[model samples]
Target: MPSLRIMPKVMTLTDAAAARVSALIAQKPGVKALKIGVKKGGCAGMEYTMTWAEEIGKFDEIIEEKGAVVLIDPAAMMYLLGTEMDYKTDKLSSQFVFNNPNQKSACGCGESVNLEPATPPGFAPAEA
Candidate 1:
């Protein structure tokens, strides 16, 4: 069997977040993994998408950390670079949070995010 390896990138998850994800998976039967990605069509131009995965597709980018599997859509990798996943709990509510460094801004409701395009390899912007 081929070893599963994650590419060295800026994306990461907090220990607390990882533990919460593990607990979620354990509580839900038949959930093989978790999928995280970005999608178009949101107030801030981009939105995060997450779903429970029963099976992993061939093109899915599997990132395993702290005993949890995070499946990333191949195409969404670029836009999700430098992202961090965190779990939050408060008096009124608790939820998974995303700290994305590429983000330029977010809407008032916090339901959407806008990100800067990924820089190409070895490419630099010209000075104005």
Candidate 2:
């Protein structure tokens, strides 16, 4: 029999991020997780999109840490690989932040980013 290979997780969450997400889940009843993706239109060419996921999608990659659950859109998986999710708070505001290795650049205001697709180790593209 062929050996089974387990796919690696796309991203990870920090303690503060997990706690914040857990709190958000508690406030909204019946929501499964926070869905994350990338979109076009930002000055940097790409922007992150997040929403409450009521149910899991067939291709969604799920990450659960410290009681916080997050869903990664399949289309954005490559762009988000090796990213770390964090929550930050200051006197003026609080927000979730993404530290992504594949990011090339971000807009001046930090509203968007430019990213390159990441290929997993040992992965090879199919012949055209």
Candidate 3:
């Protein structure tokens, strides 16, 4: 059975971001979704990770918004709660940006983020 945890608190997405994700997914016929997570490696201890999902695994947390599917791993949910996914475009750069509430700080280059521990009323961190 699929895990039935409460729905995640997703951040707001700009119209451009929604459109960009839709277009990108359309370009890859074999990709059915996008996976979002964090990995330990960046200067600030954590880095955002995203990939195309060919299929939704049994343990994945599926969050759908604006016709896009965001697949998140259960282990990464604590660091990503209340995070917003946005698209930004400027004369020199363009990319998908993550605005995460649990972030304590980020590296100077903005490539790494340090996540604060989750403190929801009834939630606790899993033992390591």
Candidate 4:
């Protein structure tokens, strides 16, 4: 039988991240998920953007896990493949951090990152 789907593994989150997301969603009105994308800015050329997703877009990739929902922007999919999100809360700071395989470098403050497209298995370098 021919397969009809190619499910792309978007990303995952740590327990702390999931817990924080679930709590934040409870405070918002009619928000269904957290939408994640990348925008050009900061010292490293790109920064991650987060917004409340009231509704999923047609091309958005949805990932539901750990009691929370995350929507990946279509354009950011290629750069976010095989990534994991973690939340850290210390006496001085609290933030969500991305452990991305496609990231090439990050700024000193960690607010921005330089990203590269994730290459698929068996991909030829010559094609790039």
Question: Which predicted model would earn the best lDDT?
Answer: 2
Each prediction's number of clashing residue pairs: 0, 0, 0, 0
Kindly state the number of residue pairs that clash in model 4: 0
**After TM-score superposition, what is the CA distance of residue 91 in candidate 2 from its true location, in Å?**
1.9
Quote model 4's TM-score. 0.92
Give a tens-digit lDDT track for model 4, residues 91-122: 99999889999999999988999998787776
Stretches off by above 4 angstroms in model 4 are 4-6, 125-128
Q: What is the lDDT for 15 in model 3?
A: 71
Q: Per-residue lDDT for 1-128 in model 1, tens only?
A: 99996554645789988898888899989998889988886788988899999999899878788977788887788777778899999999898898877789999988889977566456584455
Clashes of 2: 0
Candidate 2 C-alpha lDDT tens digits along 28-48: 999989999998868999999
Q: Each model's C-alpha lDDT?
A: 0.82, 0.93, 0.82, 0.91
RMSD (Cα, Å) for all candidates, in order, is 4.4, 2.0, 3.4, 1.7
By TM-score rank, best first, the candidates go 2, 4, 3, 1
Q: Can you give the lDDT of residue 115 in candidate 1?
A: 79
Tens digits of per-residue lDDT, candidate 3, 1-128, equal 99987754644566777778888999999998878888897889998898999999898877777887778876788788788889899999999998788999999999999997576667676677
lDDT of 1 at 74: 79
Cα displacement (angstroms), candidate 3, residue 120, comes to 1.7
Off by over 4 Å in 1: 1-6, 120-128
